[model samples]
Target chain A: MNLATKDIGQSLGRFVLTTLGVGMLLMVVMAMGGIYRGILEDATLLVNEIGTDLWIVQRDTRGPFAELSRVPPNLVHRALAVPGVKSSREFVFHTVQRERRGKPFRMAVLGLSWPSDKGDWIPLLAGRPLRQNHFEMIADASLKIGLGEKIQLGKETYTVVGVTHDMLASGGDGIGFFTTADAQAIQFDVPSEAVRLERSSRAARGTRFELAAKQPSLLEFANLPAAELPQIARPQVSAVMVSVLPGAEVQQVAKIISGWDDVSVFTRKGQRELLLEGTVEKVRRQIGLFRILLVVIAAVIMGLILYTMTLDKIHSIALLKLIGAPNSVILGMILQQALMLGALGYGIAFLAGRKLFPLFPKRVILADDDLLMLAGIVLAISVLASLMGIWKAMKVSPNEALA
Target chain B: MNTLPEANSTNSTNVSDEIACAIETKGVTKIYGSGNTEVVAMRDASMKVQRGEVVALLGPSGSGKSTFLTAVGLINPPTSGQVLIGGEMVLEGPVAHTNLRTFRRNHIGFVFQKSNLIPFLTAVENVQIAMELAGESRGAARRRALELMEYLGVADRASNLPSALSGGQQQRVAVARSLANRPSVILADEPTAALDGERGRQVMDLFAKVAHEQGAGVIVVTHDHRSLDVFDTIFEMEDGLMHRAKKP
Candidate 1:
């Protein structure tokens, strides 16, 4: 056996304890990387789940997540008119905090056209989809709202008709689906006192217009009844999602939609990029910075441990030198020990990560590529950490063995 | 007894025709530091050891016995001197003409006062590693290690770790390791200092037996003169100076 194995065998208890400590630190690092992966997944969940090939939003706006986007409710018709556009749906997205059993529950609400096959976009874990457009909602299972439970939003109460899994927004808020009409009313419905004030202001303005009118045609508008006055507020949608026919170029259809005034279009790939780079970029950076810090900490810990272990063997190293053992042999021993420690730590961390990630509130996705990358990084860190011991071993004088 | 190869004429010194020696030094001196800090550790120390000869280096503490041994072992080169090992000029002053590590591995061995065995390794593996480092095949190294342990009468404890062996047994394993490469010279610094009188004498006798049987030049630094009769020659050091003592 090599020096590393033999040394470990001799001091198995200390080796195991050290490996456990390093393993805990490694688990935290891997978890941070997994958190970043989760954020990316959450950011693109809706965009991917909607099964739409293109998105049409208000001009000069990124999307529902990046900026406030509002388009006319009728924009679905214009999107459907584009060549190769087989189907179009109005999509509404907004966050709402509602009181549930005395606590405030924040949820992301998505509105879609009713009675369309698009309702199937949400994979149900229990119950059924919303058959009737009004007073019905599908809640993500993470919200803990049971099917058939009633939740009050604005002036209306809706029943939770279905529950879906992993349906969360970029911010890790649970998602609830509603019909377009119900979502719009919940979003824009004014309080009774404000509506009364608006009506009174309009009546006062109409009375003054009647006194100042000079032309005959203008007099007709001035004397109009208050009930007949034009209403300025109308239902609006955040964006229109469009699906293209098979074999159709989505970019071509997006270009056609982009030609419209006061509107922008995005293909599927563009929407995903916007969600990832625009919506969760800050969270990604934070997690990335944490990952880097943890890696540095791990490296420092490994280096210090190795340096200490080498120091403990200083006399033995001197004896080896005196016995005509070359510097390479001593170096190999230290390096092998470092690598073994790293491998042990990694193995423990991997097992712990698999069991612990699910317990985190946010989804933690540990991909095979990520695991492979981390393994390579750990090996590199082990080599780099061993350099300190190697340097110290090289400086050991064989004469010290004589004294 | 195994016969060692004869030294070539090219490797011999002009004054050593009669002595087929394994080691020779010419006026070796080792000076540490310089200026106000300068101190002479060894002064004009010279010695010759023939193949199959075991010599005792007896001196009081701080008498530069270790300095002389280290210098001859190629661990610390002398400040001003020439050292020839196995008939080849290996060191001139503090400069090494050959790769000292490789040269030491092939032609020199060392046993320290504490046994200084690798704590993690068993007796046989510890001995085998020396041959392995010299580029011997693993199987050959293991076979030779087993043979050495058998010859040293420690074959029963070959698989026991150094910690499991007694003080004398550990030293025996160390001797086996020192002989693993069939070195021309073995330099031991108080190989039995830690043992009791009986165990220490046994270790000293093992050294003499090793030197005679393996045909190697052995120089042992020690303070225990009770075992002086085990040596073929004896030298005493005082204030960095060495001279031959009357044979006992």
Candidate 2:
């Protein structure tokens, strides 16, 4: 301890410079770690906040968070009838591109089943949830849209009613909620000309529209009626959310529902993991690779710093050895210096990561526990780096001091 | 720097003969390698210096003076021989009596041609560290270091680093550091070789006084003949052998 203190005091400038260099490396590591945490948090936001144990969705579809899972609305009734079902609500999801001030913003829009907070996942910070079924919207804080402001989606303009915080999808896109009917309208709304063209095409195909126009002529032809045209089913939904009775198991209910073979059922947790694996998995893998590269770079920098410091003091080490200083003292000195560098650098990096992270568009969540763990990692790497220099220092002979 | 007291013969001044034989070696041989490529750095070298005695080890280049010094210093073990310091059997045929580092710190002190002081430390701190290594309290080490510096006339330069000192002054500071732990024996390898003729002679005279007043053994390895008058005894090495020069 005494030797270490004196050595550090004597070379303050060099020590600070070396530690600063290490600090910069630490900063990058902290930022990457924070980004990883941020991704998980953002992806799990709605599911975690909603506090539901089971989710009912279409077979083989991860849905709303991962991919499209639109079950028929009637399934909600059957899910409620299942054993242990406390209650069930319908959740409608769509991806809407809204144009505000001539700029388009892609947002994940969830439609709340009214009159029940059980499935109304987000709690509004200001104002209230949808009282009216249609034309009302609750925007996420990150959506950058103010309450009372209107945004255009397809042919409809809906007024923003409330604001919610941290409610984001796995894609890190902003979230907004509205009534199921409005969401369906937004999903299926088309230009009037397109609607007219569809009707004209059906008429031109010699269907019901042609028979209506020649009704008087048909009457004149005595008792021969024009044939009726078949009706086309509107676009059907592919998934539903379900809540079960207080004592019943969702998996058991899901099994029964899935056995029907009309559709599949998924628990909320399963849906979440599936979403993460299917949609966010590629991004996570790429980020993981980049993080490993950053760690390698930090380790290399630590090794280089330790090596250079040892080289700078080669003569002193030789003289100390010649004077019969023990090998342990020399080794301890080098290792301690490396550890100190790591500690100081880790501290600097924690602050740097915290300060710079907020500016990034993606949420960067840095937890204290995570930072502490990263600090331990950095220290271990530094110790490993010091081994090279310490080994070299130990091998230095007192004979070199004779020179 | 204040001048050290001149060297004086201790026998005329009434010192006991029981204090004689501070350093002793018998048939010390150091070989560099084994088999067909072996080289003999020092062969069959033996010498002794009494307590409170100052001796000069004189030799030419490649004559094994350093090899003998290092062997006696317990750095490079001899291929064969015995060494005794302060009456303790320290070395016998590639073996040592105690841990080499502990033995060096407690019983032996070393001074080199360049002073070899740690440049980062002040002169006093540099001297104090030797005492610290010997397990002295920090306060005691500082106090003792100051006393040694005062004794060597370097007390005023205690705070100055080695770079700030003159060649002669640095040599004196090295002398103070050597005596910091009150070692039984002091070994100097060309300690004054880097200084001028006058400063070199002055350093040799100080070594002799330190021997007499401090009651410690002093051995100098040098090629300088100008300071010969200051040595009580002189041993010359030639071809890895030692021969005593007749005292004037």
Candidate 3:
């Protein structure tokens, strides 16, 4: 027994190589699992961290991220005075393609009248919050925007003044914050041809003649300047975020707010469940399948390695048994080798995962708990892999040495 | 009567029997296959070897000499027989205890036709492994291995691999491994069959010396009769039956 252990230790190189191979495979599986969990977490983190207690959106809509939910922006004023309601802020969202230098990047525009950095709405990582009403913007850091870089928003250009972390919309597009008026313009402003077509159709319908008759009388009496043309004709907002006073019952407020004929309210916890249960459900299933496949492939690789090791020592095992070496000794040798291989493979994969995972586009969390779970899974596979070799080794008759 | 050639050859104080036999087998038989294809490998074979005696088993092919040796060595189970080692009945048919592995490790030693030393282990380590497998502590096993190697005159080649040594030296190492656990009996199956004439005789002489000086019962299965004088007793097998020939 003592001599056997020394011999095994002396051949350390072979064992180490086998371990590294297995560990690398385990690392990939682990990273995939962690990244999947991270993506789901990031999606919901944006909603959960906000100080809002309830949301008001159009009926039959799955919030802003999963689907379009549009409502009149003025609905915020009505909800603010509802029973148990403390304050309300209107949030307008739209996706737009913008050019930074020569490259085109898709960014989500979020327009807020109140400062986006206030309350629990945004966590800023660098620079100051938006102070001026025009031209200044704050973008999610994932968008690769540097402070003070000019970002083209439609025909207008805005200066990036600050950056925020965890400020992203449902579609994985980073939220770019601006004044409400700018967001409405980008979302609903029609092109010249569409505007001209609308005007011609109105003229053909004879409605312009009545408006012209009434316009001169109004203009002569008030000498009024032209009303600021509503840049957006739709003028619809996706939802409103509401924050309640301390010790207030959010569910009661939500029920009161739901009484509105045109809008419905969703509590913070309800929205989180919808995101996980509805928004990313398909992606989660796909990742689950990937995880299952990875485990099976890992098992196969381990089995092949164990089988190969056993084959290499077929004759040695026979001779050992012939010399009255116990079945336990032979069995122990095979299992120890398998476990060593698994451990080595896991270590190498972990280091490789840490070094390489960040380079990937998707989030790869590699959390400590996930790693421990992965190690446990790998150990189970290692034991399973050795079963075949152990069975074969123990069955080797001492008579084989004679033959 | 069991041969006691010299005063220093036998020690009877600690052991109950005066002339302790290294190996004793009675009515040993082994059958392979069954029914339509039953093959009787050995039949009613019996032999007794006292301490400090070297015996050679001689036979033609298919004469069951190897089977008889294996049965007595405890490497193979017999169909029906009683096998005694150091005056204790250890096996009736097969070993009755679940701890047969430990029993074989401590009570039996084997040397093969090809030396069969583990390729990865050096000469000394090869011997030490046998002792280790028998559950001896590492320090004690190594110390005993070194002592055995020196006694066998292979201490100078202890560090060399089996492949690096000559056939004679490798056989000497195999002998050292066989004696590592201090078993009462040592079984050698055609140990010198692969060697040339000079090396074969040298191995036989070593076995004879180990039997005489170490007070072990040594059984050598061989076809070569040129070195017959080296053995104290000769047993020949024909048609799976053993017949005792003249004592050397």
Candidate 4:
């Protein structure tokens, strides 16, 4: 007795195909949400980890992820000397591209201020955290490095001590955790030939000085291996991670460090906010705008579709009216069709997403609240879209059925 | 002879009128537009139909046969007039004495030129929906729908979609639907226009059979002269006036 459903049943092929079209459109909308969530998750992954209370970076720079930042390694000692400062670790992070297994591989190397911090923070899937500082590493499972695997980095070979899952670098690249000294060595590593060339150039410059002429032995000092030289400045680190004592106000400690002109200090929360709002703000907005556009487009398409479906039933509607069908019955027909279309479309999007989302390089989190919100939105859009069709049906006069 | 114009509105039948009048209209006139675009579709059209009788409104296209049918069906109220169904007043001028939709559902039925069956529904559902909308229970409506289809001799095609049934079958199903609520008056406009002469006569005969057997006053608007013998009473229209015609 439900005329609309019975009508749809008569042309089920067309109905199914139309529902599938709506589903595909909704699937794109779902992808937009998933991609947006993925970007935010990837952006904040490292900020949530690390467990540091403050980040001390080069003056006027945002933390390392937002921009290039380098602070002297001694900044860690300065941070430790502050009252209520529990611990400080030198942070060194850089990306390394090396040929492995005859293919180019990119790895983000993060220096754990080891012996004090042995990467105990990483959620290991296998193996153990770093015990020795020099050449041991905790590799992200993304790096495809197995436990006990050894790979040459910089001037030394490192053994993979632990393998962790999903512990990616800020850029979403696989990360390898090493000691600060080992990381600095890898960052500043040079070939022996280049070292020879650089040493000779320095020696030649030293010989031109009047001090070198008065004491020619000074040139021999420059000729010694670069490591044994005394004139070179100490190696700098990307930043310093500082943690406060339990029950100590991190804001107060940060205010104390703010007095130092050489470095800018930020609480961990500030770092995350900067990365989200500054580093990935544009991408997030673009995805959000695209999501809005898609929802609007879906609504418009559904409106047109429902309107056309109403037009198809124009004669039948008039006939029903002539037979004394009330407005509620006619309205129910159109409204129910719209609701069915939207419900089926959303169902398709969820099923298709379960298979498709994983293929994306970035993680997609379909949160329960987000899914529920989208369902509500779909319901609203369905009702709004059906209004046009209902309006059209209402305009059909029963007299149209005569003659 | 109660012809039209002056004679049409002069007589009003009392409850004791013979044959038990099922539908009566007095001085029904329909006017559309004004001034330069002024047109009168039906003027002083009065009619009386009794139970167990089938009346045909015969006319050429644009002669207001359909206009009068629509007015009688309560779908398009006349610009001026009064209508009575089952010997009780139901409409005056453009105003209805009762809820027009509910009143029509219980007392009037309509069949159009091309069956006008809802395409999405099966033959039986098309019939059942009318009764269901009239407040019949689903099971009762369906059972009555099947019974009416059976009475109309299309019971075998009850489950088929409108498109699946033959043209003649679809029209029979339309008739079956009109009778689903057992309305006292049935109004049809060119109900056989889409059928061949033989099929047209058959459906016209079916209308007469429905009225005679069910004791409903039936009126059909048609220009087809081949089926004139099927109607118990006949009326012809020209311009915007109606006059009773002698049955063949």
Best by DockQ: 4
lDDT of 2: 0.78
Error of 2 at B167 (Å): 3.4
DockQ of 2: 0.40
Weakest ten-residue segment in model 4 chain A by summed lDDT = A225-234
Rank order (by DockQ, best first):
4, 1, 3, 2
Candidate 1 has a TM-score of 0.87
Quality of candidate 2's docking, in CAPRI categories? acceptable
Candidate closest to the true structure, highest lDDT = 4
Write down the worst ten-residue block by lDDT for model 1 chain B. Answer: B1-10
Q: Candidate 3 on B123-146: residue-level lDDT in tens?
A: 898898888787788898878787
Task: Arrange candidates, best TM-score first.
Answer: 4, 3, 2, 1
Best to worst by lDDT, what's the order? 4, 1, 2, 3
Superior candidate under TM-score, 1 versus 4: 4
Residues A1-403, candidate 2, lDDT per residue (tens digit)? 2555566777889888878878988887788877887887887777777666567666666665677776767777877777777777677776767666777788987777765642245677876677787788899888888989887787788888888877887777888887776777788888888776765564555444557566635323222211132244434453566667677777777787777666666677887787677777877777778888988899988998898888877877877776667788788888888888888898888777778888877788889888878877897888999988998898887767767
Q: What's the lDDT of the predicted structure labeled candidate 4?
A: 0.86
Docking class of 4: medium
lDDT of 4 by residue, B30-129 (tens): 9999899989999999999997678989888788887788788888899999999998898899989999888998888888888888888889999999
